[model samples]
Target: MERPLKGSAPNADDEQLLRGRVYGRDHDDPDPGPLPHQTYAALVGGPLDGLLLDITGWRTEEVDDGVALITELGRWPGGRALYDPRSGEPRTPGPGVSCRFYYSGDTP
Candidate 1:
């Protein structure tokens, strides 16, 4: 039987089947089940340019505040690469992209 599309509402039977069990590729099975959709933020103009940040389950305020990424470019080894939201309001660079972040600077 064909599997339901990702993100489609799960019916009672589907819910029951999924309850209390992790679904994915098992040691014996090579075929992994359908993967869920994910949200991401695109990083631009920095050491981490072109990297996608997984923003699944993140709050709006948290995304706007931006994030500090660990990179070798920091003051010391494994330092931080800071990034800020490109805009005060959220803007999607493309499909499946929740927002875009611009390089701010690096920190120790």
Candidate 2:
């Protein structure tokens, strides 16, 4: 199946394209975000409506049916938001402490 953008619902045209153009298609302009990395394997084995997501570039309450929403920003490359802050197990990557920091584009 063709995958859609992360954190957002699939559009009708994209769904149709996935069904229609699974075979060889010509390449176009490059994608906007960094290609998905190995750290993107955390979302699995559950319905995704209420999962705590924390990856970069995802809108809050974003929904996707093709793949699980990414829920971990890389704090230390191999480490992720799932790493527990206290018990050292995989905890949900909720919002970080509300801190005043410099930002470039948009604020969440």
Candidate 3:
């Protein structure tokens, strides 16, 4: 995915591309934020999304259906927004968050 230039807007094609992407998080994890330095995993479907963080040493792999984006979330002692703030549960990475993408089969 491409970020629009400052003060510029995305054209119709960019909008359509974004619409075809999918994102998900671990529903079983109860922590709102990942424990400092702990490994975390999220689900990615459809086309792969772009990186928000240039975190090094991240890994990705193919799954049975979609893809698995795995990374070790760096420590956040205060418990940051890595997870849903409202519910403190793992969920799809949204704005301002970062996740790595891995693919083995077809994607959007």
Candidate 4:
């Protein structure tokens, strides 16, 4: 009955459902469902900020998606998720690089 608002704020009903998920109340159930845009409202909050979630080992395409996710953050106000440099790769920009997921690959 409750769910996160599509591409928008977490509605009152959606918040209730998220609360349950955050506390691991109904976690065993499959399909935690579509994730929240900012990863916070989908029961996926701050823990990731300190973890190693880089695309260093992923294929180029995967890297592109990751970068795009960060770039698109500017498109949505109040969105505050950042991918930290856990792998020690310098996040330098190359000329003509599209705003997509890309691994630094320790090539800097």
Please give the ranking of all candidate structures by TM-score, highest first, separated by commas.
1, 4, 3, 2
Worst 10 residues of 4 by lDDT: 99-108
**Model 1 backbone overlap count:** 0
Candidate 2 scores a C-alpha RMSD against the true structure in Å of 15.7
The list of candidate 2 runs beyond 4 A from truth reads: 1-5, 27-108
Compared to the true structure, candidate 4 yields what TM-score?
0.21
Candidate achieving the largest TM-score: 1
What TM-scores do the predictions have?
Answer: 0.58, 0.18, 0.19, 0.21
Per-residue CA lDDT of candidate 3, range 14-90, in tens? Answer: 44543322323332345333334433333232222222222223343221122233322212221112221122333
**Model 1 score (lDDT):** 0.58
Per-residue accuracy of model 1 over 27-107 as CA lDDT, tens digit each: 244432232475666667555565567676777779878999775433444667788886665565433667778888777
Summed over model 2, clashes come to: 0
The lDDT per prediction is 0.58, 0.26, 0.31, 0.31
Q: Write the per-residue lDDT of candidate 4 for residues 1-108, one digit (tens) a residue.
A: 543333444455544444433222343557543233312211123311111232223454454344212211122433434332233433433222112222221110
Report how far off residue 33 is in candidate 3 (Å).
24
Flag regions of model 4 displaced more than 4 Å. Answer: 2-6, 23-108
